[model samples]
Target: MTPHEIGTTFYAYTAASSSVAHILDASKPATFSMVNAHKRLAILIHGFTSSHEDSHLQSIKTNMLHHSNGEVGTVIVVDWRHGASALALPPYLRAASNTQVVGHQVAHLVEELRKHHGVNPHNVYIVGHSLGAQSAGFAGRYALSTFHWKLGRITALDAAAPSFENHPGTFLTKNDAVFVDAIHTSASKDHNPLNGVFGFVHAFAHLDFYPNDGHNQPKCHNPLEIACHHEAALLYYDASLSAHNSCKFYGFSCHDWATFHAHHCTKHDAEMGYFADKIHASGVRFLATTEKYPFCH
Candidate 1:
């Protein structure tokens, strides 16, 4: 699809009580200036079949505002729902193909911020879920390759694994940004029937966090609860940003899950979610969580 054919909307949220404001029309360059250059910018991308209006996305935005203590300058929700609504293979393929184009468009907006508005690329953070996570990677890659700007960070919430597992460099990676952290909530398990229920099992970021083994989460007993597991990535991220978060998601550095489970791998420690501090670490890390609400604690 051409740049004109892709429909991406940017909604700006300034405060906790603030209603979403349409700040940018992707087709119109003039509207790009509506982005506030003074405040730190956060761009959120939702997964397939979801929109900027998604409840999970809203929760994260609200919590981020609350956690930042009004420090968060601006929150931009990237709506590419038109390309992500279809559940079939063809639509998924279309969405995947459009990822690069959307990334270019986003990079262009950031460039406008830098050139005209004086926004620092280091203050921009991109957060995405599932397929949206892959899109975030593309945006980071495009920003550096096309604009020579390295994004501050990219948070991938259980990036999709179905079509992207074998395609390296197609999804989020550590090199996409200065710091890339991923939360794998639902990955395929050996001899398990509910494989590929939500996320990719691979370690796609500098710090790949596997919460509750990153497969079937606690309290998720049925297949229908897949949303719970998939959405957990966002929940953890939201909690990590919330001031009320009392539980810290500490992970153990391990070569793999087997070594982690066998207690053979243990050398360094890492933190997960919004406040993750180990941006320099590489490889998979394991952590545990509660079965109920406020899963972090």
Candidate 2:
């Protein structure tokens, strides 16, 4: 879809079974008033060729709601599938172009929420995967530039690498939000042509968590693992929000994977996933995980 033809839709999901409301226009006051933000609000964005109804998004939504313990006021799913649809232009190019448009729309929505609904910007969190992750950064950047509003946090799940790697300021960065955390999975070292490419290898966020060296997730060696490792980042985040918060994906501060593997790094400060705390220190963090389900210990 072309930039002019982009259609950005918002769906609000709350505890009420009938709370699924479609926001036709984000710029209007009516749309903001419709949202019931009694607690924190989470805006979930999907990647290219994905939608609000995708299984991965649904799973993340379910986990967020289930673990919030009624503290989550609402979950807004940003559906920009039209803009992300495959077109004659390269898929990555299409996504890159759409990011600005969709980001503006999302920023407007947040502005409206703060202005009309009295929703605090600090109570808003954005979680996006793959190309959507880059779009989230754009949204945060727009919010700060246009409204001077800093988002609470932004969690990037294996942000897309192609067309974004080395393109500083084009994709997600620590400056996008007050606290930006990135989970790097399926990242290709040196742009390895043999490995399946999905996520960026460079550390872009304040807290960059690398699980299993950030590549070739166990049990995902086959061709069907298109987004297997990338998607695992979401699952890992979900696990962090498990009931009672039993799982903790502890991360150790490290300058590089080589030093981390060599046991040279000793400071373990950052915790990967939902319950992650905001730390002043910034650097690459390494953490190990199990190959089976309940990967986090």
Candidate 3:
């Protein structure tokens, strides 16, 4: 389908979900008031076969607002399900190809967020998962080249491995934002065949994290459980946003899991995931997680 036919839509939510119920019309200054435009805004984009209503994105959306208290003003979920639905034949590839078009739509939406609503580029954060993460990269590229505006942050949760390995232009990268970070849950360096990699193997962001050594997670032992392991990144990130969460989301900056496991690279200052305290972070890090939910333990 063409980019225009994709009919990408944006839904905004505040602390009180029922209060402000207008679709984001960037042209209208009044639309800004509905979402308390002055505070920090987050835009979430889901991966293939998912929509704004999907639990994958909604969990984070629901948690962020509840956990952050009133600190975060608005959470916008981008609905490009028309381009990401299962009905699209050749499923994965079709959704993958549409990422570029959806990215263009996001780029325009992001530009309007500032121009019409008086929101600064620095106050915005774009978070995406899998194919959606790659699309977020495209948005960052378009925003920079077209508008010369740099976004504050972009968090890529396990960017899709297929269709984006060797193509720098089609995947999430550090250049996409001032602070671009990614979590690798189902893929690791070298991506050995026996490991069953699903997430993109490359460290494509400023802070690339390898949880559970970036291989199959605790319960995702079955080789064919691609979807299970891939969603681990999303699960870990959402848990980090919990208001009562302790400081258990930390990792050591190391060369690889070997270095971290061997008891070297002992410094574990920066908390990984949603509230990663260290912003000037560079290079990959390693951390351990449990086999079950509330994985931070």
In model 3, residue pairs whose N, Cα or C atoms come closer than 3 Å (at least 3 residues apart or on different chains), thus clashing, are none
TM-score of each: 0.88, 0.90, 0.91
Question: What alpha-carbon RMSD in Å does predicted model 3 have with respect to the real structure?
Answer: 2.5
Q: How do the candidates rank by TM-score, highest first?
A: 3, 2, 1
Clash count of each predicted structure: 0, 0, 0
Over 1-297, each residue of candidate 1 has an lDDT whose tens digit, in order, gives 666555777887767435657667644667765566777688899887889999878888877666765556778888888767685458777877777777777778788778867889988988999888888888888888889989988889988776677787787888988888999888765523254466887677888899878875786777655477787888778777763446677788876677777878666477787777434566778877787667763
Compute the lDDT of residue 231 as modeled in candidate 2.
Answer: 80
Please write out the lDDT profile of model 2 over residues 148-185, one tens digit for every residue: 99998898999888778887778889898888999988
**Maximum-TM-score candidate:** 3
Model 2 TM-score, 2 decimals: 0.90
- Minimum summed lDDT over a 10-residue window in model 1 is located at 188-197
Looking at model 1, residue 242 earns an lDDT score of 65
